[model samples]
Target: MKKGIRRFGGYKFCFVAAVLAGIAFVIPAAWAEDGVTDSEVVIGQCAALEGPAAGLGTGMNVGMKACLDEVNAKGGVNGRKIKFIASNDGYEPDKTVDCTLNMIENEKVFALAGYVGTPTAKAALPIVQEMKVPLVGLYTGAGLLRNPVSRYIINIRASYDDETEALVERIVSDLGIKDIAVFYQDDSFGLAGLSGTEKALKKRGLKLAGMGTFARNTEAVKGGLASIMAAKPGAVVMVGPYKPIAAFVKEAKAAGFNPVLATISFVGTENLIKESGDAANGIIISQVVPSPDDTSIPVVRDFQAALKKSFPNEAPSYGRLEGYVTARVLATALEKAGAALTREGLIDAIESMSNADIGGMSVSFSKDNHQGLNKVYMTQVGGGKAKPVAKVARP
Candidate 1:
């Protein structure tokens, strides 16, 4: 009888241990999906934080953190605070891939946000797809990110195609200028803008008067300048970051080859102005967001307040404002996803935002459409400041 009782007790103990072990395995799997925890969600950013394009990345990070901090201060979304981690890629494609891999494999981020450049974003896309991680609000409007619409990538700004269309329209219609030329970086980002320009000009029964190219992350605009100068275009559509574009503008002005200079929104306006000094004056720039100085817009007002609260010394900028807007859109989707957050749930929530009003901006998404805002605004540099251009005229 004693031997039989001991055997029964041992059997029961083994069964209970097995059950507890199974529960232990299931609990972690249920809670730790990607970077989610009971009280926090982790998001990562890989951008040019320490190079010539550092302004773009740092501004975006500041804006995103400001908005996230505001959300967390208000008790977070669905009782979970967002913990953002940013890594620098120096706007290099190879570094971007490495940073993205680390973020997903090591840091285990829930999603990626505020990526800086087109080339960088292009490099990270394959990894994003393979890992099934969502990338929201990248800072490029390249057609590749929008066309065919990857389930893992979300864009918040108007496409380069859209911005270039607006620019070409104004260059031809408002300015009544023809014989347009292009000065672009010799890379994915510049090529995307060049393609957009070609498409827009083709619609108007016109072709590029001249074309010139420069390598990425370097200010080698002399060769490109000479090529475009020879064409003597009435208006030149410059494509690249602020530093290179600024260098080109200054060199062109110094050489007395000034034409009506115009650029897409990717050329950070304030930084361009600073880099080119007075040379930036009379230059036209397409803007994806409203003038950061325009506080009349409800979203602008909120962005300004949030920025001041979080980054006390920082001033308003288009790049930072875009980051703020992207964060707001992402937060809205998180709220819609509810407490049981998963990667698919977050993506579904983002798609469900159809004509959704984020403060004053209208963002829309669907299963077939992932690009959010399509509106483009025009601005011009004058007196070292970028002001809204209500009317376009030949300079």
Candidate 2:
């Protein structure tokens, strides 16, 4: 899969813990492959800060450190100043290969941002392609890291074949329903949402009325609620994380085996409605980004007035607004990678962002696409919260 490291696989780091909560300060290595200087630049993450997907690694490190503290309070990006660092691979892939080789051979970090899981990013995908670095904003779409397209992995969101083709077009044309089933999470991010809902149900000629699994950070969802309630499928979907799909939707509605569950936005939406309280209400998720309470979209109203003036009551979510639009698309590819940054000029300035508009949704990447955003919104789960799904399909 593109040169070596098998594109994305293999994990064998023996020990290496201690980073999250300890924060980072290490800057020893000066043979900088490109985390720059003349101010700062270093980046790093290695997610899952302490177990059962610590709320998707502290809501993607509090939205990538509150958008890198609002781009170092506006004096950064292009002028540098980014440091970051984080580590705790509690989502574990051999401790995310020793926290990506101690943040690229000992805190040298030039790039790699907002990482979450997909078997802890397939063990840091052969160490970010043998130290070439530049893995921005990845939270896992897992087609072996956007299908062999690892120039340094910059994927934004939307994939799992664009959230299972917008969740099979609103579960077969606005919930008309098709005996769907699939409980997932046995690996590779629930077999890539069970191969994107079996290729969006074989493009509608339909399929998959049953399939189940579990085993990842285990709550051991009773054999996926006895193989999706012995194929009683009227709709199931769920694919992993969020404490085994909120313990397989609270043991499939206390063994009554309800349906129309649906999921994926890599689960964890408010940790599956605060751990399936009312069995996470009506379920159904599938966003890429946008609608952290819409906020009329101006970058989710500047991510809800800077996350309520920096966490003062922090609530706007969708995992910290997709980590504040992946740190505003990594500060717009390090301010278009000028100021002489490297790591292949921030992966050619995020593959020369073609669609670019980061205020009300729009992000692109090229060199034949690194999947910045294919779109896909769709949300649900009433009173317990998590809105959105009205006209849906935003991409």
Candidate 3:
């Protein structure tokens, strides 16, 4: 009887010790090192949180925060909490590279997510490729990020080609405007958008009526606007950032060129409506995501609720949608990456996903193709709101 009691006690003690060991194994490691083990997963982002495009940075930052916070509240991903360390690059390529390198080297983040800008994000591609870190959902329209086959980067939004082509098609088919002109920034972004516009026009047996290119950070777009206006095109398409877009519109309006305006997804028509006052009326632009003003859409409603609950003081904006989608994609990849969460595992998991849908829009990815959202939405400014006219188009 004594021997049997001792045996039973020993068995119970061993079982309790094994259970404790199992709990320790399941707990993820904190963000003290590069890879997140069985406590937290650290993701890094280098966004334009300050500088000229601070509004965009703020929106995206808020979206990412809302998403990660929600995830943390819900017990995190794979029994590990997500910690995002987002830095402001001030829209400078040098600063972007520095911040990204620091995140990878010092912060020891598992992957790079929601990086902002074309020039800045492009600058860090070499290092990301060299280090083999998963560069997912870069916030840029430059085709090179997903094209010409870079192994590291994945794009969350549609390319400029998709938006530009859709706008050009509408100009030719729907609006029936023959003499079209283009005002583009004189960089990779400008060239890529112009290329798409040219291709679309060429299909309709039409050519550019006039063209003007401006350097980045130069508000002297009046000269370009004048050049485009001189052709007296029935329609004009602009490919530039918000500051330049606003400057062009204001200058063009001042010059009395009231031709129908069409632009890529980055036009920020709502913000422009507020800034330009009455001048923004009747301006049409493309959108890859749902409009904030449209509360009927389920995704927009959910997003609004998320924004309202998480960030009450701030209003939901376009860039915030970008960041929200960015977080969603990363979360999907992390969920699918399984228990052994490494950078390589994440890359493989994301690359394997095809036709991945996040609420309203759908994204596709493959081993050879990294461009996620290839669909574009065409929207027009009417009655003090951006109204989506047509369904999404994929290229």
Error of 1 at 161 (Å): 0.2
Q: Quote the lDDT for 296 in model 3.
A: 74
Candidate RMSDs in Å, in order, are: 9.6, 16.9, 12.2
- Give the lDDT of residue 39 in candidate 3: 75
The TM-score of predicted model 3 comes to 0.87
1-395: candidate 1 lDDT, tens digit per residue = 22322332456758856876777666664274779998999999999999999988998899899899989999999999999999999999989988988898789899999999999999888778756799999999999998889999999999999999999999899878878999999999999999999999999999989999999999999999999988889999999999999999989999998689999988888888899998999999999999888988999998999999999999999989999998999988988989999888999999999989988889999998999999999998778888898777665
For model 3, residues 239-304, the per-residue Cα lDDT tens digits are 876777778888888877788887886555556666666666677788777777567766667667
Worst 10 residues of 3 by lDDT: 1-10
TM-score of each: 0.93, 0.34, 0.87
Model 3: lDDT of residue 339: 69
After superposition, candidate 2 runs with Cα above 4 Å error: 1-36, 44-74, 77-99, 110-112, 121-182, 188-211, 214-229, 240-261, 267-283, 286-293, 297-299, 302-395
Candidate 2 C-alpha lDDT tens digits along 1-395: 23234333334221122332243345433233545677888888888888788888888888878878877888987676888889788887887777787787778788878888788887777778765677887887878888778788888887777887787778778767878988887888888889888998888889998988978888888977897788898887888878888888888788787778878887878878988888787787887886787667798888777777678667878988898889889988888878767688778878988888989678878976788888787888777887886643221
List of clashing residue pairs for candidate 3 = 27-38, 28-37, 28-38, 28-39, 29-39
Which candidate, 1 or 3, has the higher lDDT?
A: 1
Residue pairs of candidate 1 with colliding backbone atoms:
none
lDDT, candidate 1, at 210 = 93
